[model samples]
Target: MNAQSAADPSAVNRFLKSVVAWSALFLVIVLLAGLVDPRYLDPQHKQFLFLLGFIGMWRYSNAFMHYCRGMYFLYWKYPRMRKQADKLGDQALPSEIYMVVTSFRIPSHTTYRVYRSVFEEAARVGVPVTVIVSIVERSDEVLIKDILRRHIPDGAQVKLVIVRARGTGKRDGLAHAFRALSRQMPADDAVVGVVDGDTKLLPGCVANAVKFFKLLPTVGGITTNEFCEVEGSELIRQWHALRFAQRHVNMCSMAVSKRVLTMTGRLSFFRSKILIDPLFISDVEADHLDHWRLGRFQFLTGDDKSSWFSLMRAGWDTFYAPDSNTLTVEHPPEKNFFKATRQLMFRWYGNSLRQNIRTTKLLGYERLGLFTSYVLYDQRVSMWTCLLGLTVSLVASIIYGAQYIIIYFLWVAISRTIMTLAYAFSGHSINPMYPLVLYYNQVAGSAMKVYALFNMNKQSWTRQKTTLDSGSGRFDAVLNQVSSKIMLFSSLCIFFGAVSVLIHLTQRAY
Candidate 1:
């Protein structure tokens, strides 16, 4: 079915929800700025005014991008465009296309059984398959060995890599595997496919991916569409599904059209030679260490981003195989707020910072379409616009009375409502309730950006250990703060505008 048919709506509800959310958000920002300083109109208060405005505008910029992207999807992406990708059939099966599945946290028995089944599928297709489980916990090593012995096919090359951590965190574990794998494999042993252990590969995923890699020499790697196996309770999982769909079905394709800036981490492949290249990883062994080691620069946090950026820098093309599918279990946020927020903060901040660093470096590189708009755009207005809005509203409200402030807010609310509805109705297949999600996404993001900005110096390399229960608390805090701040800012704006009008009236009366 085409995406257009799927986007049936609950538009009235969406519009109303957007009005409430946007109004509340604006109000908080204005009120908070006013409480901080009622005299923002004074010339001496310029720095203070700029600070509040900067925060509001930064939040606004983030929302505007997502809004624009949603609009892009509405007009361009529905299932009609999806049909084109469907036409590219999987062909030319290769016997030597080895599938490598990597796992870090799965229980030993489950890990073994998954590969046992996977090996069977590969053998059916006539290609050798290998499963590499990074034994994160020493206790899990025995279970991994058991899986290797029982599930590994007679002819398939099953390699068990044990990551003995002399150091702390996920970075060490991944670094250990990367360094070891680089030494063990050569450049020409066919493209190496990497998948998370939990991923259930579609029967011909490996075979079809081989066909894709063969189509272009510049094709550095490919990733498959992911669907969640676990469901229920946590709405965050659904958000992920939506995010996954947008990226795999849309952004990746767009990235390919414009030369990919970076590749996704989930289920990616690389030319084997790229791994062994002197430029990719160093030749030195960790002197009798069981696991190989690479410098932090060669092995960085957010491994997937590192690979994507490296591939681009090395002048290789990358693309996503949206039709090729991998279903994996989804871990959703618990109903708790902190757990969710913390997880998001870590993931968003960590990825953003790493990518920010990568983009800055790329500005000097010989890559096209890699320019970052945020870095280039002058935000002079952003530094004071919200504050200015607040001052004008407050002054106008006092002179003309509160009706003026209320009227202006109503206009702002109405504008947002219209945009939300227009965005939803314009062919994007997002669920009608997506605007609520969209609203929350913006408010939550503003809180995140605020936190990340303050704590930017305290960056951590280790990906946080997250489960459903742990993230809710953090997210709740963010949601509350965002809601409050936006409301506060809007109130302050009305106050300033009212005051301005009142001063003019008093001068005329005098």
Candidate 2:
């Protein structure tokens, strides 16, 4: 009998839903674009709107090009890496594995779940595992031991070492724990993981990821795919899910180049050789950046960025493992929807821009690979590019008519819906409201990035409610503030001036 594979009902249903969603959005765009009569458009109004239209076309076209390349790498090249990795996985790895779990002010249940999964997966890996649990309270130490007692498979070699930190920050915790692991003098091919307390490992997570170190000897570290379980409403769940889905695309695309932008703090595996280096330890512990205006300022947040920059400058390649996946337990700072999301975006994008600046200076087509370097450079421009279209429309609405604003709103709705539908392919649950939130993430996230670019020294931990001491000499601090404002204002003015010239609205761009 000839049998054919049947289509998945859920996938088919999702496809149909996407079709209907786009169809409706298109209709709305058509109606909105025609809401006002052409007679109402003055010469100046027409020119501004036309320039704004060019911006939209240019931005979307560029996005389409990048997305196509991303799809090519994700579906085509990544499988090749996985196939080679599988061959390596079947071999007996003589090297041992190590992990450093940093837990501070985390819920008891969450800590238990993380360690349980870590140990269970450690057992599956069938290797001697050394876990350094960095904690402030002794209760977490006791909690992890109980999980190990009840859950560790028989004959599984698991060693537990507890290090109590001052609860200052995750960087300090990771620093002490990682240095402790380094002092043990693990083998050259040994693999070590940096796991956040809030991140729980799934079965096969560690096993799937660690083999890559042996497979690609040049690889210094790798971060796994993350899907989040939010401790908030369903709205926040979808928001977090959307983020990871997008991250999957970017990571996979960059992985094709044998380089990824960041070594995420959540769940990353490193080569013991990289960790044991005095330079690597110093970067993670007390890394400082020399800014042109700000001089040398110690990094207050973004320990992950420091680790990644260390890898980059040290000439080690970083990668993303799609099959290796973990669950991130996210706790939004507060209940208020807007307030919570803003704080998160502010932190996330700020870290990105801060890293983007230093990373960009390393840009060379041959050095970083063409695609990866382009992606880093794009990150700097994207914060502003993402806002330009909307800014133009709003300016046009004030100078021209309310219809321009209405039409732009409809354009955003339709375009974002189409974009969100494409994200469904990443195996995330898609919500209708994702279009709205996606727009919010782009605009709000971009604004925060710009702000962070200027105020690079000011940083705060969202969960711990702690801030670095940003105090400096009063005269120098005032100069920094003034310089930041001047740079920000000048940058925006130059951006607007260039846009104005596109429609012959201003002579200044030339």
Which candidate gets the maximum TM-score versus the true structure? 2
- Candidate 2 TM-score, C-alpha based: 0.89
Per-residue error at 266 for model 2, in Å?
Answer: 0.8
Candidate 1 stretches with Cα past 4 Å from truth are 1-95, 98-102, 105-125, 144-167, 187-189, 229-232, 282-300, 332-335, 370-433, 460-510
Model 2's lDDT to the true fold? 0.80
Choose the strongest candidate by lDDT. 2
Q: How far is candidate 1 from the true structure (C-alpha RMSD, Å)?
A: 11.2
Each prediction's whole-model lDDT (CA): 0.50, 0.80
lDDT per residue as tens, model 2, 1-510: 112222666666766776786667667768876685665455645555566667678778767766676687767877887788787665725368998899988888788888888888877787888988899898888888899989986678888888989888888888889778877889877888999999999988887888777778788989989999999987788788888888887777677777888889899999888888888988888877678888877776788888988998888899888878899998889888778988888787777777777677754666687777777777778788888877766765676567767877877877897888888776666777678789988898888888888888777898889986756888988998899999999988898886565535622212
Q: Model 1, residue 208: displacement in angstroms?
A: 3.3
